[model samples]
Target: MAYRCPTCSPDIMQARETIILVPGLLCDDAVWEHQNAVLSRHYDVIVPQLTRQDSITAMAEYILEVAPERFSIAGHSMGARVALEVWRHAPARVARLALLDTGVHSASADELPKRQALLDISAGKGMTALADVWLPPMVAAGRLKIDIALRERLYAMVERMTPEIHRQQIAALLGRPDARPLLAQISCPVLIGVGSLDQWSPPEQHGVMAADIKHAHYDVFDDSGHMAPMEAPEAVTSALLKWMRDDRGLCK
Candidate 1:
C-alpha cells in the first residue's frame, strides 16, 4: 500500500505517484517514451529494460526486486502478461494496472503453429523479414502510407533484439499462465485499452476482461491497430491521465 504524504492530497498522490511501465517483446524504453515524457511531469515513472528475462514469472520477479514497495503498473503486449503475474505474486504491492493490446488467456495450441511459423521465418529469412510479416498488421490502416518514420522506428525496435531473446520470449509467451480466474480477485484499479483495428488483440477480448474485473475501465481506439499508444498517442495519453485522476474504482 502507498503511504499518504502529509503535505499531499490523497487524490494528487494517487494520480502523481510512482509508476512502473513495461514494454512489449523486443521493445525497450522507446515504446513508452511518449507517455513517459508526459506522465513523468506529475508521476514518478520508471520504465525498466525487459530484454534480460524470458519467462513472465521470472520477469515479474525481477521487476518486484527492483520496483518500489508499492506502485502502479502499465504494460503492453507480452509485458502485460508479466504485469498480470506481478499482481498475482504480490497484489498488495500493485496500486493499479494498465494492460494495452494484451490478453489474459494462456497460449493456445492453435497459436503455436503460427508462432512457430514466425520463428522459422526469423531463423530462415532474417529479422527484417520477421518484421515485414509482423509489423504491417500492428499499425493503423494507412499508417504505412503516412507514417514512414514510425514504421521505421517500430522495425528498429524489433531489430535491436537478437534471435536468442526472440526464442526465449516466444517460449515464455507460449507457457504463460491463464489469468482469467484471477481477474475477479483484483482489488486495485484496472484499465484495459485496445485498438479497434487490432487483429492480434481485438477489442472483444478487452471487453470480456473489463466485464469480469470490478471497476475496470476499457478503451478502444478506433483509428489504431495493435500499437494504439504510438498510433493514437494523444488520445491514449489523455485517457491514461484521466484514469489516474478519476475514480480508480469506478465500475461500469
Candidate 2:
C-alpha cells in the first residue's frame, strides 16, 4: 500500500522495507546525504520534504500519507520528534525505528523562554543573525574552527534557508508536545543514538528514553556532538547497518 499526497506525486516504491529519513529543524534533505548514499545500497530510502507543513503533526502526517505501506523510520533532532509522532500515530506501520540525537520531553521552562527568544531574534535580525547564534552550539566545539571546508559547507547550507522557514520550525519546536507518555505504547524495536558531547539533545535524555521504551537499544558516539551522523558518519552508518541487518535477520 502507498499513501499518496495531494501536493506531490506518489513517490513511494516497493521494497523489502522502506526507511524514511527526517531531517532536523530548518534542514532539508542535505542532512541525510551520507546516510541515503550508504543505506540505499541495502534498502529503499525515502527522505520526504518537511516543508509542506508548519507543525510537527502535519509533517508526520505528510510523511505517513506519502510513505510506503511498511517502513522503518529514522530521524535526527527535530526530525526525531516527528518520527516519534509518526510512530504514535501508526505504530503498526513502522517495522523498526531509529531516534538519533533526540529527546522525548518538550523543552523545559528555561528552554521555552530561550526558544521564544530565538523566535524574536529571527524575526528581528533575520536568518543570518539566527545562524550566528545557533551554529556554534549546533556543531561540536573546535571542529568548525579547524575544518574550513566543513565550516563553509555548514554556513552555505544555512545561507540557503529562509528566515520564514526558520521561524516556522522554531514555532513547531516550541509547541511540540512531550512524547515521554507515548513510549510505553510503541511496540517496535528502537535504536537511540546520541553524541558524547551533544549539548542540544544530550545522551542523558536519550538514556531516559531508552529506559522507558521496551526493546530500545541506545548508543553514544564519542568525539562527536549534535551532528553525529555528519560528524561521525562511519560510526553512525556502522550502527545503523548492523541494526537493520540484525532486526531483519540478514547477516553480512
Candidate 3:
C-alpha cells in the first residue's frame, strides 16, 4: 500500500510519485528532515525507520515491504548501501536511485577492529560518549566546531539509538556485499553524491561510482562532510529533485 502523508490532499497524493528516504546508521528520519518536508509537497515521501533490521539485505527487504509498487529511493551512508541492495533485489520496482555519502565496496581489512572500538565505547560509556566520539568525525571539522545546532542535532540523533542497534548496523556494514559489479547492471537513473570534506566516504569514492554506473550523475556538496543531508540540505535536495524530475532529462 502506498503511504500518503496524512496532511496531503487526495488529488495531490494521487498525482505524486512515491519516494523512499533511507537513513544511515545511528540516524533516523531527522537526517532527511529537510528533504522529506520539501519533497512531500511535490511527491509522496516516506522515511522508513531502518533501526530494526540488522543486515543491509534485511533492511532492503523491510523497505520493499512498506514501499509502493514503484518509487524513487534515496539513501545516505549505510542507508545508501541498503538502497543499492533494494535495486539488486527489485530493479524494476525502483524508478530512480540516489546514493549519498556511501560506498559500494565490501568492508576493508582493518574496518572491523576500528568499528569494534566504537562499539566498545557504546558498550562501556553509553550512546552519548559514542556520539561524542563518532559524530565529530562524521561532520566537517569546521562545522562540528562552529555549527552548534547541527552538532547538537546529530548528537541527539545518535544518543536516541541503542548500543545494540549500533552493533547490528556495524555488522550489517561489515557483511555488506561488494556492490561495484551491480553498478553497470543498474538500468534506472542513479545519483551518486558526497560531501567535499567527507573523510569517511569521500567524494573520490562517489566519483568512481559515477563512472561505473551507466546512467549515474555525480555531485559534491561543497564545504560539507559525510552528513551532507544535514550539513548541505539544499544542495542534496536540489540534486534529488532534478534526478526525479523526468522533464529534466536525468532519466534518459
Candidate 4:
C-alpha cells in the first residue's frame, strides 16, 4: 500500500502491521533489499529513508511521524540507534524489535577519535573512498580473498550513494547516545542477531544484550559478516519468521 503524507506528501508505503527497516551508516534501502523482500510476504515492510535528517533523534522522529499506527521495527548498525531512539520515544507503539549487528554501548573515549576520523574522511573523501577503506574489515577475511565479484558489488553499492547523504549518516553515528539503559525498557520480544566475523559489533555484544533484555533472543551467523541480512539472507529470514510466529502465535 502506498501513502501520501497528509502534511508533506512525502511518499510513504505501508504493509500490514508494518515492519520498518532502518539501515546502517552510509547505507540506504539497498542494504535491506533481501530481508525486505522476504518479510513482505508475511508483513508490510517499510525501509524509511534516513537521509533527510542529520541526527539519530531527528531521524527517529521523522520515522515516527510517518510510520503506521503500530509496527514492528528492525534496524542494522546506525539504523539500530535510530530504532532504539524510536522505542524510547514511544515504546507502546512497537510490537516487536530486532537489532541486527548493533550494540547499545557508546563509543569509548579511546574509540571516539577513530570514529571521528572516519566521519571526517567520509565528509571529505566521499562514500567510495570510505568503502575502499571499510569493506575489507566489514567482510570476513577469507571471503574477501575468495569472492571478488561480491566485493565489487558491495563497493559499487556504496559508490552509488550520494556523498552528502553518507555524511549525514556518519554524523548520526558519531552523535548517537548509548542505548544500554533503554534495553530493559523494551517490553516486546526482541531478536538480537550478529555476524560471528563482524568485528565492528562483535557477537559478544549481542550476547550481552540478550542477557539484558527480559524477552530478547540472540543468534549469530557463523559464515556472515556485518551485513548479515544481505550476506546470509536465508538464515536471517528463517530466524525472523520463526521469531515472529513464535512470539505472536501467528500463522503457526
TM-score of each: 0.90, 0.88, 0.92, 0.87
Q: Scored by Cα lDDT, where does model 2 land?
A: 0.80
- Candidate 3 vs. true structure, TM-score: 0.92
Best by lDDT: 3
Residue-level lDDT tens digits of model 2 in 77-171: 99999999998888878878889998888767787778777777777887678777877787789888987876676677676777677777877
Candidate 1 lDDT for residue 99: 91
Whole-model Cα lDDT of every candidate shown, in order? 0.83, 0.80, 0.89, 0.79
Query: Which runs of model 1 end up more than 4 angstroms from their true locations?
Result: 1-16, 246-252
Cα distance off (Å), candidate 4, residue 176: 1.2
TM-score of 1: 0.90
How do the candidates rank by TM-score, highest first? 3, 1, 2, 4
Ranking of predictions according to lDDT: 3, 1, 2, 4
Q: How far is candidate 1 from the true structure (C-alpha RMSD, Å)?
A: 3.6
User: What's the lDDT of the predicted structure labeled candidate 1?
Assistant: 0.83
Off by over 4 Å in 4: 1-15, 248-252
Which pairs clash (backbone N, Cα, C closer than 3 Å) in model 4?
15-44
> Which prediction has the highest TM-score against the true structure?
3
| Cα TM-score of candidate 4 | 0.87
